[model samples]
Target: MIPLRALLYRRGTPVMTLLIITVNVLCFLFEMAQPFYLRESFIARYALIPDQPHALTFISSMFLHGSLLHILGNMWFLWVFGSHIEDAMGPAKFLLFYLISGIASAFVQFIVYFGSPIPTIGASGAIAGVMGAFLVLYPRVRVVTLIFVVIFVTTVDIPAAFMLIYWFAIQLLSGLGSLASISNAQGIAWFAHVGGFLAGILLIRLFREKRARYQYR
Candidate 1:
């Protein structure tokens, strides 16, 4: 199921979410504009490689994308789920949550593949954190998802709680499978997704405001 949008709305502007999307898009455009080797070098410097881990890459790599499809997919989920999370936590706390969750994701990947030299790039981990927070803030909220089966296509509004749990399940199962498998064919950081999501679930309460003023107001 492809999520079209969340059926929930917030009163304030989701400035942080928009800022994040803009940054990711701009970074992708920068990556595209560079020459082949130059881009590779740039990604090499910023992308998080588990073996040669750096403090900055943990955050820098969140804004980088390997391809157009990659950026679009990550940004779409960020736009869909991030706004509500930012709304719930406010911009400052939201940004903190994103960075910490992303860092947690990088750490998870690093620990999982301790000696691997492969560089991991993308916003999937941080976005997964937003998804987790979205569930926490709006569990009963409905997500308008597009479902397509063969020639049949339709949209359905599924509860946020269920949809997010399902998503986490996929990430966890994939993570476990990655652990068991000898080959990492997809090169996807399933552990990062799981880590970010779990971090969000654990951190939302700490970041969320005690007396949030914008609940269905």
Candidate 2:
């Protein structure tokens, strides 16, 4: 199911979400401009390779993308769920939380595939965290999702919490299956999604309290 938008609205402008989307798009454009060799060089330097000793790559790799679809998919989720999350946490805190989630995601993925030599890159993990925050902040919010089964395309209104929980479950199942099979897929860091999602759930209390305080003022 592809989420088109959420029914719930925030009280304030979502400046942080717009800025993040712009940055991700700009980064994708930069990646597109580089030559094949240069692109590989950039990914090698920035993307989080499990064996790499440098810690900065964990943060840098989140902004990197392997393909247009990869970046677009990540940005789509960020745009769909990030606005409400930013509204809840406010700009500064939202940005900090995003980076922290991405870092945590990278750490978990590294641990999951410590023996593997694949490079993990993309903002999906951070965006998944944002979705998790949204699930906690607006569990009853309605998500407009498009489900395409065979030739029939139907749009359904689903609760944000249900959609997010289902998504997390899929990621967890896929990650476990991959590990069991010892498969080396080029993309899709399921463990990163799992990690970021768990972190977001753990951090929901801080966000909720802050929002409540702001609402009282």
Candidate 3:
């Protein structure tokens, strides 16, 4: 199912969400400009490799993409779900939360595939984190999803919580399946999505606690 947008409305503007989309688009354009061999080399160097603990790659890899579809898919989800989360947390906190979730997601994936030589890249993990936060903060919000079965295309309204939980379950199941396979060649970082979603949930709880204390002051 492809999520088009959410029905939730925020009181303020979503500047951070727009900025993130712009950055991802610009990064994808840069990737497209490079020659084939150079682009591959760029992805290998910047994308997170399990064995390489290069500090900068963790941040850089999140902005890089393997293909047009990969970046577009991630950006689509971010644009749909990230705005409400950013509005709730404010731009500064939202940006920090996003980067932290991405970093945490990469860390967990690296731990899982410590000996493997595959390269992990893209912003899906971080976008999954945004979905997690939205699930908690706006459970009643409705999402417009495109469902294509056979030749029929239908648009359905689903609760944010249900949509996110289903997405999380798919990632978890895929990750588990990858673990069982002798060769981890799924070409997707399911574990990163799992980790990022969990990080976002935990961070939201922490933020709520702080907000509560501030309100009581």
Candidate 4:
């Protein structure tokens, strides 16, 4: 299911969410504007190389995208689920949550891959954390999702818990499959998604405010 938006009411402006999205978009544009050789150099320096991991790449890599479609997809997910998460946690805490989740995801991927040289880039892991927190904060909330089945296309309002759980299941299964595969081709960091999600689930309570002030729509 492709989640279009969350049905729950939002409280304050999602300033941090918008700021993060803006940063990602600007970074992608800057990356694309570089000449081929320079672009390669930029990615090589910023993108997290699991083998020769840098102190900064764990955070830097989250803002880099491999393609236009990649950035669009990640930003869409962030807008849908991240707004509410930021509303719940407020701006400052939400920012910290996002960074922590991204770093946690990088660590998980590094542990699994060990000395692999593949560069992992994108905001999927951090956004997965936001989705996880949404599941905990608003499980009963409905998410308007676009579903395609063969020749049929439709929209369905699924509970956040169900949708997020389904997503997590896919990530976990894909992660395991990647481990079993013998191919050396670069692939999605499925384990990073899993790690970020689990981290969000575990850390949401710590970051969430003691009082929820948002009004239900």
**TM-scores of all candidate predictions against the true structure:** 0.94, 0.93, 0.92, 0.96
* Candidate number that wins on TM-score, 2 or 3: 2
lDDT of 3 by residue, 1-217 (tens): 9999877656567898899889988998998899988988888889898877788988888998878889889988998888777767778888988998899999888888886778899998888788888777777778899999999999999887888899999999989888977265549999999999999888876443243211100
lDDT of 1 at 46: 97
Per-residue lDDT of 95-132 in model 1, one digit per residue for the tens? 99999999998889888888777899999998898888
Error of 4 at 174 (Å): 0.5
Give residue 46's error in model 2 in angstroms: 0.3
> Where is model 3 poorest over a 10-residue stretch in terms of lDDT?
208-217
Tell me the TM-score of model 4: 0.96
Tell me, by lDDT, which candidate is best: 4
lDDT of 4 at 14: 94
Q: List the residue pairs that clash in candidate 4.
A: none
Write down the lDDT that model 3 would get. 0.83
Candidate with best TM-score: 4
Off by over 4 Å in 4: 182-185, 213-215
Prediction-by-prediction clash tally: 0, 0, 0, 0
Q: Sorted by TM-score, highest first, which candidate order results?
A: 4, 1, 2, 3
Cand. 2 Cα-lDDT: 0.83
Model 3 clashing residue pairs (backbone): none
